[model samples]
Target: MTFFSCRPDTERRKVFHLLSFLFLAGFLLIQSFAAHAALVRIKDIADFEGVRTNQLIGYGLVVGLHGTGDKLTNVLFTRETLISMLNRLGVNIRDREIQLQTHDVAAVMVTADLPPFSHGGGRIDVTVSATGDATDLTGGTLLVTPLMAADGEIYAVAQGSLATNAFSARGAAASIVHNIPTNGHIANGAVVEREVPVDLANRKQMHLSLRNPDFTTAGRIAQAINGSLGSNIARVMDPRTIALDLTLRDSIPALSRIGDLMVEPDTLAKVIVDDASGTIVIGNDVRISTVAIAQGNLTIQVTETPMVSQPGPMSNGTTTVVPRTSINVNNGNNAKLGILRNGPALSDLVSGLNAMGVGPRDMISILQAIKADGALQADLEVR
Candidate 1:
């Protein structure tokens, strides 16, 4: 009787264990599907209008180089710039009849991006590149350079030691160099003296621009924004732009929420071919109609053999040389022709092409021919 009762309890336990395992497996499957369905966030595909970086440029001088700086004799602008800088610092170098020949000074162009909403006193990175004939900029210190925007107004000042991340070594006859030695970067090297006015909090409306313009993607983004936030808050302005109605909602928080919303972005089917590198990139949506393909190469080979004939014993006979030649040709008679049906998926298209036994360059030609025949359904871009 005890054995019978224990058997019932054991059966009940087995059923409960089986149900638990099944539930966990189903939960994991659902999670995986959701993860795959959510392709990308709104922020990854679009950007808010007016939220952009401004380019700033300035010309300056770098010093403290070990004979790798520009020669003042060859670069007259560097000489004039150095002399003018010295005069500004209360040093009367223009009056003196001194032929200034310094190899430790270099003329460089300073460039940086002034981020939107950047305030005064905020630090930003700067890039310094040689404008004159300077061999290397390693271990160089840039002077105080005033960075200006397109309006010719000074916005920031940069002055710091450069980090070239490069080195050069030379012997009497040979030399080895790494990365670009004439370009250097300075982290937090510039101090913003002025800021570009951008009032995001008080804006009544804003626009979102898609990185890759596509009609289907713009519509999906608008729908996702409207569905996640409120109805009619977002509308598609064009294939590349989506306008947001921000009169009722707070601009900052609304943008934050909208950016986090995820939607699967769509793209046009395209096939990119780089003939120089023999690279082929096919989009997942690329398709092809029914077509036949045959690829072969003609090979011709020539051989020449020379034989020497000598006079036998001391008989008066002149020695002679005979040349034999042979020629062969292969018309690729063993190559098999392949037929491809209309493919519904990228894998099917790839498999059909692979069946023809062709390389990337040959594949490129075949794709071009197919496109010309109106069989390839994707845009073929050659770079």
Candidate 2:
């Protein structure tokens, strides 16, 4: 009879636990909703495999300079190239003593990025760097030069007025240095001479790559995609990849229509710390699992005092010197470890640490130690 009478109490306890769990879950749901409201497009997460820029570089001459060119002795290529060009121009000067002051010129290397899907005749910007000992390339212009890619193929032609923000002036035993002319830029200076083939619509399916791969994030991405385009349109390939099945879609337009759909990504909690830069970055999702943190500074000081004696006021003894030393060590007694029980969120951790007057750098080290002690649940990455 007693066993049967205890049923009501057991039933009441079970109901109370269920209600408490539901209340906590509902609170967490609301917090998660408010946290990630800025939705990013799926296209921003992935890079198309072959769609990239090709670095093109070429050696060229920057002409029309004003008394700022290479020192003939250090740069042999400049003199040799000038002689060859002059010879090609039918100026026959023998003896290789071609020591003409090409001060109105500077040797430069031109560089440009050949963007993927670049077509012939497309214009691009180019960077020109002085390879010679030119003081400045300011107010100068670059001669027409062909830029070549790694394959030795001429990809673009660069020519424009050089704009250098630096200059230099020199005199005997003294020199006035200004902006760095060793590097300059030309806006819209090169015309693309080659095309890179990229076909986005040719394939029946596509893959979305994540910038930072996380399994939880990938699942969320898949859910977001399927929520917008309906189920079976997107599937998770891995933590870093998602396959989109465009074959079963209505048409190309339908697939393209979903590309603009925005979805909020779920990222893992992490705190990135750079010790060399004294920087600390905390993510909103980071949480602390109930830990105590204390901070203190230990300082050691050493001082030296030197005393010189002059033979007791000219008693004719060689001056003797004596040294006095003092050393002190201080261990601060101000900070004490404080207990933080059942720590739930990142702000609580930050507040607790900041309340102790811990700087960002010190906080990073303390957090790392807490992580090592198994008190911090989030990842602490030191870069």
Which candidate leads in TM-score? 1
Clash pairs (backbone) in predicted model 1 = none
lDDT of 2 by residue, 1-383 (tens): 99999999999999999999999999999988787566777667655445578999988888777777787667888877777667778977655565576676778999999888789999999999988788788888887789998889998999989887777877899988776777899989999987777776666677777888877767877787788778887788888888878776664575556556676776787889998989988887877767776778898999999898667675767988899899998897877887655556767767777777878878878888888988777788999
Off by over 4 Å in 2: 1-36, 64-68, 87-95, 100-105, 132-135, 165-181, 248-255, 301-329, 339-343
lDDT tens readout by residue for model 1, 194-309:
99998899997899999999999999999988888889988998899999998998889999999988888988999999999999999999989999888887889999988899
lDDT of 2: 0.79
lDDT, model 2, position 237: 84
lDDT (0 to 1) per candidate: 0.94, 0.79
My TM-score estimates for the predictions, one after another, are 0.85, 0.74
